[model samples]
Target: MGSDGSSSGVVREPLDYVGVTNRTSSGFSLIWDSPEEKYKNFVVTSKDVGKDEALKPKSTNKDSEDDSEKEFDNKEEEAKYEQTNKSESENPRSKDENRVPESVSTPDPQNKSGTGSKPVTGSITSFKKVLPGSSRFFQFEDLPPQTEYTVTLLGKGPGLLSRLHKLVISTGPEPPKDLVFSEVTENSLTVSWTKPKSPISGFKVTYTSIKDGEPVSVSIDRGDSTLGLSQLSPGSSYEVSVVSILGLDESDPITDFFMTLPDPPTDLRAVNVTDTKALLLWRPALAAVDKYAIVYGSGTDSELRVTVSANAAEQQLSGLQGSTTYTVTISSQLGSNESSEASTSFTTTSGSGGDGDGFGDLQSKDVTPRTARLSWKPPTKPAGSYRLTYQTEGQEVKEVVVDGSVTELNLSRLHPSSRYTVQLQAESGGRNTAPLSTHFTTDCSQELLNGILKSGEVDIFPQGRSGPPVMVYCDMETDGGGWTVFQRRKDGSVDFFRGWKEYIKGFGSLSGEFWLGLDNLYNLTSMTKMTLRVDLRDQDEATFAKYSTFELVKRNYKLIVGGYSGTA
Candidate 1:
């Protein structure tokens, strides 16, 4: 009621009884009966205290002795004191029923009342002086929660001795702050918060799914500020609340909302594939989505991407390659969140004409050291002709043209054990189809001889040969094995006489009576020791001439032969 203490000569008497009227997390209120004896004013003061200090026995020092004498000095105190006249009543009340209420106190530095003047330090102290006619109720506000406070009442006047009454009480706990959600996934999320600056026994966490409005609650230790929740539905919204607890009291709830990640599209597949386009289909995601992202790529190529609205169940991809395998992935998106991807693969059908037609199933067969047979299915539409081009690693491309009716062609003069890429295109009315490609490696003659068992016309690589393999007639069933025939004359269908140039350069076929080139013979014989055999064949009888250790000099027609043993 009053801020300053009363003037000197007024008589003062202690209040009769002081009791708590109301209390909250932040503050409390107190009420006291007016004293019977005359008094100018009553001073109320309070300071925060630790639990241990609040429970300690009251000190018997001079100030405390005086406080005891004035404790509950009025009529209500007299009745309660007489009822329970036990020695333990001398102690301050510690239970909740008798806990002290808080009050704002104003300092009265000018008061010259009769009392000791020792200063109170390191504590929150205030004085509220009530006049004779003012209300006896007082409230203290803006106090820390879950904290103990010591409050004292003193009747002060000029000639009257000052009396002190003390009480201890605690405020309710404060709520936690700064609630946050982290590490959120499709079915789980982590919640954390800042602890309130007050003593608390623990925390109570409650969450309810917005979809079903079913609430779940859990108790958490005071030391932990984070909790992980799982076993929830994907793409769901949840309301979460946190409350701090102290003994039987709890703070107001702090609440927020959170969401789980959306589900991804499922059962992705490709259909209606064409040489230049493909259609992608999938089952819709269970959760609502904003869009869908599709990504695709072929072997070692940069990936391509496209997007479709969430309502769409299929997406068409264009500008794809024919007869090529590709991998594709699809994912659902909601707001800024994207779900995990669902993936599939497919190959486009061959084109009908221009750029991606014909030759989709190009293949190679009968591959030898120096020759291979190339074949393919005819184009969907007829064409004037087909052009074929081929090349080995680090070599110039070679090309050949064939009639539209030809579906297969024989390739010749290829190197042994070499990799080659062949591309074929169908041409019609000056326009050409997309080139279809295939790869093959030529076999060495030695491999064919060893793997085939029987040999006729074959290709061979002489010792130290590099440019290309040689075409030859191998006599595998002779007296011994593995013979290269440079000359054979079993029929008169071929001419024997020929110019020097004709002899120098090969003018023969391995399957007929012909002569192998002198240049080739010289190269083969010069590389290593060789043996030659000449067979004379008539109607039913045949005679043979044989020579071991034979050689042919280069650039000249010189011949060397020795060790003949066959009858001629």
Candidate 2:
């Protein structure tokens, strides 16, 4: 409606609902229809037309003036009514503003839907939302570096209302260039990245020991650019991904993996031992290790077993028997880092048994005494007569020749009841008798009588002496076999010598001393002056080579003469 109460040919058409336009005037007034009606007015100065007049606030003009003003207003009112009647009251300034400027080029404001304007140039009302109350905006801060994440903005109301200004601002720092893990310590790791180009709201890092799985999150405060991951397992590896947030936008995720420092070998010890069991022990491998191997055996034969971290130095082994020799070698990874190894071994106890000549021969029987009547046979050997060589226990061997073919031989005149050991010999030609031996105690008793037979006729002899008495018998049986009996007297008794004369080869002389030969027979009367040369061959054989001169004292009637035996 015009001021004159007529339709203006400048038709008051409705503005495009998406844009604000007014055909009435450059300035307008909003009237409140409340009980206290009031008006809030706004004015558009020449500054609204691209002139800088903002310094002065302009107001609408309203005045009752002179006759010229009244006439001008009347005519202006007529013109307005004529335009309304013609239905041509369009906003003239709107067309000029819509025309593209010749100096500046721009894309069509129409959107994919051919909407009124593109979000890029859209007014404050064009803000759109993706999620409700789930978004935040970043002002001046740069996006986190080497990080990945997602962001969402929320709209105030439901429906197709473009309520979110979600500028999916790639504004997120360029997914932190060169996201890296460094300065790793025993229990912590430092992650750093390049500076971002745009502002960021927050940052998050996902990390875990496992691969291809959901990781744990470490959030960064608004102003922090670096992350220090703590409480990390020592000697462990972790895969990390970063998520950066900028306003309501997120950057592409970046992933990286790193391992913690390695630990030293543990659980070192010596295990079981036998005569040959290998020793063993083990420890878990650290993250810095490439593999593991063990060298174990008797101090010899060292074996190397290759193993990975998962199968680290376990208690299993090859070529290692229970209670056998072993050497352990635990090795770590190689690089700027140095590796290490250790070794040990032990032996098992053996069963109780052994082999050898453990004992000497032992005599099981006691020998007879007084008369060394010993019955001994070779305990083990080629049999022959026993020489019955004996010596007192702590005395030099006193060789005695006992004559007899029987295993039992009587040795008369042995010290009464003295102990003696007889070594039986199966002596052949010249060999010594290595005889098994026997020992015995002796029972020696005084002889009943003693007698001596000299080279002379007996003048008197004791006869019919019936009493307990001791006697001595001496005879040169080789020359003359004679018997003389006498009663032993404690007081130099006078006794008679009665000769049996039958053994005396009358009128003959004899030579040499009557002694036992090496044959052990009381046969050969060895001449003291003669050389009885005997040649000893191998232990088994011997030969008598020479028999030299010899002499013997003999009695011939009333004269004592020397008997000579020529050497042959």
Candidate 3:
């Protein structure tokens, strides 16, 4: 008898051949030849080796059974099946033991034949029955990717030992995971992903522009996990897909969406500035945008941000501080994406008298013990009149109005050695410009006989009452008070090694280290008999040097002293 357990002359195997065809990531097909003799039916079973639980056989519907019986009735279907089988047979990998026929009995855990035997267990399985003269082809569906499956086919007949044809096949690789997009710009973007654990030869990447509906594709080696795409439109959207690939197989594509950055606004500038507001202008961006974002602030201050319609070419900023410089930045935006920033700077006019106005510089000259002359340049814009106000701390403010054509004023009745703040404003047609302000101290000699004893900066007219005021430091507490300080070196905040011109005009602040001008020194010493006292200190130690008489001659400010006495 042959392997089919038949008494006939020579019985052939139930199936001549079994091979896999139409393999995919999720499913595959099994094709076999017709048996030598007509059989009641054929039983096919499949098991996933990676799974442990036994799977119940699937019930075949009457329609499916009828379809299977006539599967091979169509000549065209037979020819297609033959072609598929031929191609699979040509592949050397198809000749493995998995594709060869074997002799085996179907296991029945119930032992329905009353035979003493143990049933097979611990395997997930699915079963299908095919009638004789059927298509000789069966398809496995809805299987996991990158999984191994064992499929078996057996012929059933009366009083016959059916031979089994078994084969092992695996689905295609799984798709990539955790896809990400980064480093996006106006014209390019990057995409990356985590490769699947399943073995694969490479990947296929495809991206489509949502605006134009044009797709671009690229192939990448399995070793690479990232790809960079360029030449994209700004402010545009895109859809990307990644698929894992193996020999003659590709996984379902993983898809995602992203956007490119927009172009920034151009030619940003400040068009106008006032004490409380500013107007900014810019050109529109070349790319399409939904809006524009504006950010403005002064030095070290918290910035304020606002947005305007994309069609707007100018923005008005309000509630700003006067006489302060501010920086403004503008950027174009589309959806969640924003473009690079375009920036500019401007300064606002003064808000009030306390803060100087944007008008011309104000100066004080011809100062005396009881009078001062204040002068300024005319404002760039014409004014109807000018208002001048002056006051000292804790004193009532005084005001004076002058014709707009006048730029200088003389004030009288000012206290000797007293500091006064003066404010000047230009008014025209009921509107006034921000005030221009300055401070000045009336002149006083550094002597108790002059009725001045304060230790502070003071204006002195050493060349008599007709000359401009010369500011100097008076040290009233030392040597019975009333000492004029010509030179001081307390802190290193000021640079002393200066050119002759700087020295002639004096280069430091009276509140800090300073040198009284040489010309002032010559005029002062030439006016009165003065005593010189020098005090020096290092860390905690101190010393002094004094001269009973001191004076400076006119030529080159030559110094002369007599009767020196001190601990130095």
Candidate 4:
């Protein structure tokens, strides 16, 4: 505070604690603590602020400038007077005068003819502006942070007098605010923020994935408020933080959380095919999904839908039509949303649809040099009849047609000990199933019997035995087809079965070294021997009865007569 421009016997006290507090990036709180205040204008001045600063130099160097201005004016006047005294026609000066010694004609600063100009005065601070204030405090806003500001508070006093107080203060830079995320994809994210109140050097964006446990950071210029982060993990949660920086100081950070979507399913396929059922499988989602949804159908009108657990990678659909093509769409579902669809198509096994053909097992036995016996039942599908087509080397195809009721056929005229390709296909409604194929060769010396195996049981023997051989035959039969032939092991354990279908039909193998028997033949007495003979008592009926066993000897193989031998 100050008094009027008069020697009045009065002393005015200064406003108490007139300073700044609560300094921020762009502003600070200015306090004028005086209770009684009467002023016309509040003049505020902010000096040049820097990180490392001493006292700011004065704005104008007046004293030295005034002295230099006077000297320069005196010289300029002396040169002008000399030019006026000499014309183009003036006599030459004396040689002594022309050769005047150095420093003899120097101008003096006290010359009355020189114009003495007063040096200009400038304000002492870098940034000065007038502000309005009343009461005890004035909030000084919009000042730069991280800088040194020497602010002088001024007030108009009585008459032409003014009161002032000089202070050094600076505001802190503003921190970035309201960070948001957009355009979030499996591998990247875009984040944006609102600019703060004051200018800053830049911003520091720090982000980290919770699943990966790694953090990344980048610097953004002051002109840019958005940052794009790339190379991120899919279906992962991340935390992002944005902070404003001014010089070496940084504002408090603002943070947010987000997650990337899981990738779509890949490599979809079908398996375990049947007329009415099929199994569907696919690779798991690349990232993660709440669950999976499948839209499947032959077409749009009959579309069907199903849902699977998030971790499930496969599904099975039943009640499908045989040989009918189906289209399936799979998608990764997250929350209330689902990803783009991945599609695939497949057709069920054809030939048989609905309950057309029942289950059946095929087997073969009694292979000779020129003939092989093949037996089957329960058509994969119902059909009119069975056809056994066969041929030998350089021979015409010979086909044997039989009623659908028959199940066994003997393939003849095959080459001796030669391989032949065979096809077994199920037929229904004039449509043939894709043939199930096999290969077998005619025997060299061994002979086998021909018979139907509808009951899953059969008896085999050589055609008219004449000499000792390496094999023995068992002609046992069962009601439930319970007695399966057992194969003997070198260790003496009958743990394996002789698969006759494997040997004759080329389904598998049965060597001469393995023993054969019905492990559980409930229809026969334990180790009991039986024989039968065929007879026709009526013109329409033919049946078989037990026959007597023949006493045969062969040291190479002891043939056990344990099964029926009958004619039909």
Between prediction 1 and prediction 2, the one with superior TM-score is 1
* lDDT of model number 4: 0.52
Model 2: CA > 4 A from native: 1-170, 183-188, 197-203, 208-215, 220-226, 232-238, 243-252, 258-266, 273-277, 283-291, 295-568
**Residue-wise C-alpha lDDT for candidate 1, range 431-469, written one tens digit per residue:** 876556655656432333223446587766653327566
- Sort by lDDT, top down from the best: 3, 1, 4, 2
Q: What tens digits encode model 2's per-residue C-alpha lDDT throughout 1-568?
A: 3312323222221111111111010111111111111111111101111122322222223462211111112334234334422342245344432333232223333333222121121111112111112111111122223222121121121111111111111122345557877777645879977645656677777887652243578778557767888866445568887766654445566788886665444433333322223234444443335555555554554455554553444454434433233445565553333244543333222212211011112222222223544454322333334465676545578665543344555556554334455554444344533333444443111111111234322221111112112222323241233322111222323222324342231111112212111211101111111122323344675442443322121222111123333332
TM-score to true structure, per model: 0.41, 0.26, 0.42, 0.36
**lDDT of each candidate versus the true structure:** 0.66, 0.35, 0.68, 0.52
Worst 10 residues of 4 by lDDT: 66-75
lDDT of 3 by residue, 461-564 (tens): 77655577788787878878878888889879889999887776677788888888888887776553457899999999999999865766444555768779
Return whichever of 2 and 3 wins on lDDT.
3
| Native RMSD of candidate 2 (Å) | 48.8
Question: How many steric clashes does model 1 contain?
Answer: 7
Q: Candidate 3: what lDDT?
A: 0.68
TM-score of 1: 0.41
Say which candidate scores most in lDDT.
Answer: 3
